[model samples]
Target chain A: MGRQLLSILLLAPLAAILVSLASRRARIAEYATVAAAIIDLAVSIPLLLRTLSGSLIFAHGYVLLDAFGVWVILCVSIVYALSSIYAVGYMRLLNEEERLPTFYALFSGFALTMLLACVMNNAGVFWIAIELTTLVSTFLVGFEREAESTEAAWKYIVVVSGGISLALLGTVLFYWGSSFVLGPSYAMTWAALRQSAPQVYPPLLLVSFLLVLVGYGTKAGLAPMHTWLPDAHSESPAPVSAMLSGALLNASMLGIARFLGVVTGTSVSRFAHAAVVGFGIFSFVLAILFIVRQTGIKRLMAYSSVEHIGVQALGLGFGGPLGMAGALYHMLNHSLNKSLMFYGAGNAMRAYRSKEIKSIRHVLKVFPVSGILWLLGAVGIAGAPPFALFLSEFTVLRAGIGGSYRWVVIVFVIFLIIVFIGFLSHFRAMYFDEAPEGEIVPLPFTAWRTLPMWLAFLPLLVLGLWWPHGLWNIFHQVFLSVMGGGQ
Target chain B: MFLAHINSLQASIFSSLAILSLLLTFVMLGSHWLKNYVYAFAAQSWLIAALSASVGYFSGYRELYAIAVLTALFRGLVLPWLLMRIVSRLNVKREIHSVLQSSSSLVIGACVVMFAFVIANHMSRQQQGAAHVVILALTIMLSMKFLGFLMLSVRDEAVSQILALLVLENGIFLGSQILVPGMPLLIEIVILFDLLIVVACFGMLVRFLVVHAGTTSSRELNRLVG
Candidate 1:
């Protein structure tokens, strides 16, 4: 039954894509996509429940869903489901109804591919699914048919496809090395590799892990390979930006984390840890530098996505129960928080009719509710108190200090502070600064638009204040699964 | 003993074909004509197809024969023809923009091959004979991919960059063939089909650029900076 549900979760979106194409009317396409997203969420609920009870590993060991994968699927579906509402509002507001059919088809297709990527336990299947995400999202990124959109899409495809092709080579290397120990029968299966990690040649494993890191790391938006991210995110439509920054990056990170899981308990674990930690730290620091200089509101949010993903990577690299749990929890928190922030930014852009941060001012005076929600989102994302991101960041910091990485923790705190100040500066200017004379032409606002923002933030606040018992159990199980029963 | 003798012959044939493929990549680097670049890529695919077929004959893996046929049909014939149609439609007969002089690119390509030989030798020092040759082929594929990336970064024409992407994909295919010959045929076909779709999308983008922007030069694609 669980396997059947997973298939439905994967295949329903293809049906949605066809339904979207079958209708020429934009309303039909739009409604069809939203219906598909809701069905995806309904399917994921049972799958997550089944996973929490116990992992569902079937399909000849190729399809495995544990606590971590289940959580990723849940969060992705939630974001997609909610963002479909925002997509309806924003795409219509943008008034490009002619593009709706392609948009809806690619939208659901992208979601389906991401879900497929999360479920595949075979490394080869994993890479193919992730590559499909890129191919599908390339069209999504280029949906607007403008020069900037097309150019961003081109750069996106080139850079990400290049990075992931390298990942495929790494998968081959991994198979070649693992075949020596495990034979060809069970080679490249994540469960098999993790079980026999100690028997594999250490040097071969090390090289393969490094290659996979660079390959999947690029897709996950880890710097210094993150050149295409800001352009693609900023140029894409608001809902796509939310998905790319929120859900898609997590799917790719799940790819990297799978390899990380396999390489654990081997001599090369430390090397892989160092590499992930180093990339994470670099991404965090570089994001601050870029965020401080960014003028576009969407680009500002995009850089912050880089920073949060970096923080999650850093937490996982710290490699203790607390750290890995923190990283997993942080993934969920960041997805909601980042998607909320993008939604807010989308509203602000629509009201002001510009993405330039400085062009629109006195947001509080014009759109008071969304302006506050947007401000709270920035605070949450910047690791302020009373939000889930702050709690996750604190947990990771505690783990780093407990692990005797005081210097790294200190540096991490410094960068977090810098990012906080960077975000505050932009937020203050946008919200509190005076609008130019006659620039306060406020567009009419609606509750449906801000409803998703409230829905996203409520749980964020609840989780921050009190970690629910069920979620804690699930997160702990996920932590154990990732650390391979405490390493 | 008979199978072993045939395998030895297969190894030498594989080595020579691998070297020929590497030379064709360099030929692509030195060529100024877009048509020549496409032709060189197609020829390299033919060599790879032959190598796969030979591997199948020796190993008796029928799936590899299927792979060879797919490679020949798709990479050897269909892709180049599609690219040629796009080229004719765009009316770009030859490369007008050069990022590096032909002689310098040739030098760089030679260095890349030598570098691969050195690294592959050191990495596979324990392996003997045909195993070493296969490892060398893998390394050469990596080097060709690196060269393709270099061309992609430096080339100005969108068409040339697309060609560079094809070279990169070909290099990956060769590496996979040498390293994981037992990969599921499902995945192999999916990768090939993905290449087709990506190339088609890229071709469409090139046409869009030509029709809208009046040139297919990626250098003009600077309107989306930071």
Candidate 2:
């Protein structure tokens, strides 16, 4: 049953790609992508449910459907479905009817790679999958063919490819280190690495872990290495941006979390946790600084991604059931909330005919219902209460406060306030500020545009008020599988 | 295991090939012309392929023979051919906007090699009976990485940047061939094909850069700033 669900989950995107390519009409391609995405989301939920019983391995251990992997798959599928729906309205606005089929094809291909990255059981194969995501998404980032989009695509591929090559080197080092213990011909599976971790030289293990962290950190949009993220995210069409932030980053973080799992209980574990916390704190500080001074609306959202990913890093670094649970929860909430924010930004960018926050005024006047949804999403993403991000952030904070990294908890709280203030200030200007002079024309409302926002916003609100029991059970399993009972 | 038990002749053969590949990276770093960079990359790939074959012969990994052929075909022949096509399409021949002088970059590249050697020495210090070949492989692998990144940072042309990235991959491929020859053939083969796709994508993007962005140099591609 688990294997069948996994097959369907993987094949749906492939089917989408085929349908998109084969169809002559743009609407057919768009509808096909949406259908594929919904099927993937539907399949992934049950896949996660089935894996809750225990981790599932298939293809002679090349694919893993553990709770952790399935959770990321769930996040990717959610974003895929939402973005595909959003793209239907968004791409129509671009008026590139002839190019839409190709766009949908690449979009589905991009989704396929992210999903593939999640289930890769071999570390080497996982790196390849991540690399494939970069390759596929570069075109999507440059889909608009504008100067900025093309430039952003260039930088995205170069920086990410360089960074991920470091990950490749680290994986080689890991395999080499394990070879000393497991012989020269063993598979470089996560389980094999974990089994050999204690016996490998501590210094080698530490160096390998740090290299992998920095490498995958670049992909996950953790700061300093997150230079490519803002350019790529802000420049891509809004639906593609949603997928990049909401899906790709989670897949990369899955790699880091799994690597961290490999080194758990080793002598280098303490230092490893500290390094993660260091990057996390640094990213938080950097993101907050950028968030406050931001001008572009999507760029503001991009920095918030950097900030939330930092928070997730902190959760994983804190190393407990609570920390793991919070981080996983944050992944889902951030996906929903960030997608909502991007969809709103997309709507405003289209209606106002500008990408600048200063240019977009009186959002409520323009998009009465979706505008309110967007405003609440901005608040939620800013780590405000009665929204899901707040619950996850608070949970991560709870995990940190009693740990050795208690000082991080203090720093995390101070910045959460700063992020809330900095992020919402832009929204405040957009929502409540009076419109400049002439009347701005609003685009006609379409369910294709606002439906995803409503779908995303409701979940963000409910998850914040009440954490589900089943989710807690899933998180517990993830915590055990990833933390290896060390905490 | 391969490195630890290698005889002196095998050790010398591996070290020479590794050092020669590192030299080609320096050639890439010191050159002003984009074509020079591509040729240097091609040479380096061939050397690494040779090293892969030698390692296979010495270590008895029969699958690496196929890997060596693919590396030579794809990395050595096909990638450089694709890169040359990208270069010929562009009007700019040399890095018209040099971020650093070739001589200065060469000096910095030397420093990077020394730093890499120190790190490699420290890393391999724990292995009992570890050969100097092990240290040499680690150092050349790491040094090529640093030099590749240096090339990436200092070069502005799109083709140069692409070559720098290929150099980075080559460094990792070289390291893996020596350090973990028994890594599954499937992964090695997939990674080779993946690099092909990457270059093809880069070729298309370079054309996009020229037609849409008006320049292949990153200096002019900075329209999307914070």
Candidate 3:
């Protein structure tokens, strides 16, 4: 079951890409991606069920699921399934036919690489997979073939690639330190690094931690190093942007989490915390500032990622159950809300063919379902009541102040308001004003697209309104296990 | 003792050979000719290969020979050949109206080279290794590209821009190659692949600049500045 399930996750996308190569049948290509997504989503369901029961299937060495990997993978698969469906309708409107085939293939490639990255237990393997995702998605970011798109892709590649390079260097240095503890023969597995942290060389470990923090932090879209996020996210197709903002960023975050777990020994954790705290506050403030001044819908969301990643890193840095849970929950909530927003924004882009915020208005009058969904996503992301993000954001704030970082809490509250306003400014322009001066056509909502949205949004509504015990157990187990007996 | 003195002198000679390649980087900053820049880059790679060979002897790392030979073949031979083909096709002469005057560019080049030395010096204080030396050497090469970019940004010629690009590749190859043992092999290969793709993309950028936009230098970066 372990081999089969893992093979299914990895091979399904390759199969889709293989089928996509046969004839220029965009219909078949769309169906293939959607089918691949469904298969991946279905596979993740059993894993999720097992995880929720506090019985996760770990196989292929450390590559198996405990609680944390289970939820993170499930989130990725769910988003992948939805984004593929969204892509079908999204691709139909593209003006260029020449790059469509490559785009479809690359999208599948990105999913395959990200899935492998999410599941890998070995740190080196995980880092390589994340870097591979960057490579595969570069073309997607540049899918439009415009100079701005190319420039965005170029900047994304150079910045992230360089950052990941530092990540590699950091990984090597960390492993070099880990060698002293584990006796150099053992591979640098996540379990080994965490389990054997006491013996790791403190000074070497400190350098490694700083390197990975800066390197992966940049890829995670944290501030001071987040120069690539807005342009890359805003310039790509809305669905591509969705995957990037929703899922890819999280995978990198997960890698950083792995780095944090092992690197933060009792002696060196303070250094890690200081770096995380400094960058987290800076990123949150910068994201708010950028979002407040943004004119483009996609660009606004990109900056919002900077904010969310800040929250996530801050939670990890705080290092307790409440903080970790809030961070994990925010990860999930942001994934759902951001993907939904991108889907809605995809529709708006189709209708208006413009990403400019002012040009798109009265989307509810033109497209009722998408406009409402977009509003819900925006509100959910802004930490509206009963939404998981509200719980996560609030808990994180409590963690910050309880930990005596009152200034962080203040900044967090203020930025939350700024982001909320930025989102609402677009939402109001989108749904409450005059109808857009653009053509309104009934979009090609492939069953893939519509089904996933219904699956995703309805559950979001339910979860926001009530708490599920099974999920609570998943987080509880995660809090107990993934934290490695730490607070 | 006699043999030790001879080896030290040999090492210094090998390093001085490499030093000439680093000097080649500066020569391009003040120099104007495309042929001169390309020739200088080729010489830079040869010196890098030679320096690696010297390090190999000192460290007794046998694999450095293969690396040295590969550098000569790929960097010194194939790349320069490609650049010559491009140079002949474009029939470009010299870069005069570059982004900066030779005097300013020379000054900026010195500052950048000094910055590279400082970074190298600081990093060596942490843990001394060949990696630091290689990174600093590459930094010098990269500073040339940065200076050339300032030139390209102000200058108006596709050929100069491409020459600047070739200089940039010298830096990348040095950095990527030297990042070894400290960096994973996968990353080094990926960096190489990135270099190749960026070259292709820049190739296309140059084509568009020349055939469509009627400008090749980075100077035409005005229309989108808002």
Highest TM-score: which candidate? Answer: 2
Which is superior by DockQ, 2 or 3? Answer: 2
lDDT of each: 0.83, 0.92, 0.69
The CAPRI class of candidate 3 is: incorrect
Q: Which stretches of candidate 1 lie over 4 Å from their true place?
A: A185-187, B1-7, B211-214
Q: What share of the reference contacts survives in each candidate?
A: 0.35, 0.85, 0.00
- What digit string (tens of lDDT, one per residue) describes model 3 on residues A236-349? 898798889878888888887777777555577777776777788888888888877778878888888898889888887776777777788778878887888777777777
The residue-by-residue lDDT of candidate 1 on B18-100, one tens digit each, is 87888898888988888999899999999999988887777666799999999999999999998888888888877777778
Best by DockQ: 2
Listed models, DockQ each: 0.46, 0.86, 0.13
Residue-level lDDT tens digits of model 1 in A177-216 = 7766665435367877777777776776787788889999
Query: Alpha carbon lDDT of residue A457, candidate 2?
Result: 98
How high is the lDDT of residue B179 in model 2? 89
What would the TM-scores of all predictions be? 0.96, 0.99, 0.81
User: How would the candidate models be sorted by TM-score, starting from the highest?
Assistant: 2, 1, 3
